[model samples]
Target: SVVTEMTGLGAHTLRGYERAGLLQPARTAGGMRLYSPRDVAIVRRAAALAAEGINVTGIRRILQLEAEVALIRAEFDGVPQPVVAASAERGASGTG
Candidate 1:
C-alpha cells in the first residue's frame, strides 16, 4: 500500500523533480502519480534535503557521492553490490 503520511508536494516541486531527472513515479490509468514505497522514501528524503536549502544540482551530486560511498563500503566489507551498472547509469545521466 502507498504510504499516506507523506507531505503533499505542490505541482511546481513535482515539475522541478521531473526536470531534475529524478525517478519518475509511475502513473495510474487515470493519470495520477503513484509513488511506490521506495519512491515515497525518495520523496521524503528529497523534501528534507530541499528544506535544508539543498539545490537540485547539489542534491543530485550528494546522492551520487552517497551511492558511490555505499558501493565502496560494501566492497570494503566484502559485500557484492551491483556497482558497475549503477555507476555507469549515474555517469551517463548527467545529474551527478
Candidate 2:
C-alpha cells in the first residue's frame, strides 16, 4: 500500500490528506490506515502535481476531478456509442 511504500511520512502528512477531502482509508478493527488502490493513486498523483508547481488546494481539486473522470471514462468505455455520446454530453454539461 502507499502508506507502507511511503515509509518516511509522519502522522501529520496522513492528516493532511484527510483535511484535503481525499479518501479516508478504511480502518481496521484496530484502527489503521488501510489504503485502497484508488487512494494510493491519488497520493501519487498529488505528489506529481506538487512537483509540477500545483499548490495543495489545486492538487486536491485536480485529484478529485481525475478520479471522477476516470470512473466516467470507464463507464463510457463499457457502453455502446449512443451511451458514450450521452456520457460525453453529461461530462460536458458538468453533470457527470
Candidate 3:
C-alpha cells in the first residue's frame, strides 16, 4: 500500500513492474505480492525515471546496474583482506 500511495501507481502497474523484472517484491504462499521498504524505494526511483521519459527497458537496465554497484560497494566496504585476495586470484585465473 505504501508503494501505491507513494508512487500514485496502481497495483496492476506495480505487478507489471514485477513481470518486467524491475521489482522483486516478496510473495505470499498464496501468491499475493508483498512490498518491502526497499521495494518501495526502488519503485519510487522507477517512477521518477519513467516520468523522466525512460522506458521500462532502460529503467530495468539502470536498476540492474544500480543493484550491481551497491553489491560491489558492500563487498568492498566490509571485506576482510584474504577474501579480497581470493577474489582477485579468481579473477586472474578465471577459475571462479
Candidate 2 wrongly placed segments (more than 4 Å): 1-10, 82-96
Q: Which stretches of candidate 1 lie over 4 Å from their true place?
A: 1-5, 79-96
What TM-score do all the candidates reach, one by one? 0.60, 0.64, 0.70
Q: Write the per-residue lDDT of candidate 2 for residues 1-96, one digit (tens) a residue.
A: 457456444467666877888658888999877877777767767767767998888988898787799899998678899987897899999999
Deviation from native of the Cα of residue 12 in model 1, angstroms: 3.3
Per-residue lDDT of candidate 3, residues 26-92 (tens digit): 8899987889888888888998999999999999999989999999999798999899899999999
Best candidate (score: TM-score): 3
Candidates 2 and 3 compared: the better one by TM-score is: 3
Question: Positional deviation of 57 in candidate 3, in angstroms?
Answer: 0.8
User: Tens digit of lDDT per residue, candidate 1, span 1-96?
Assistant: 233345577666765776796648888999887877766766667778889999998877776787799898888667335766676688899865
Q: Which model scores highest in lDDT?
A: 3
Specify the poorest-scoring 10-residue window by lDDT in model 2: 1-10
> Candidate 3 regions off by >4 Å?
79-96
lDDT of 2 at 14: 61
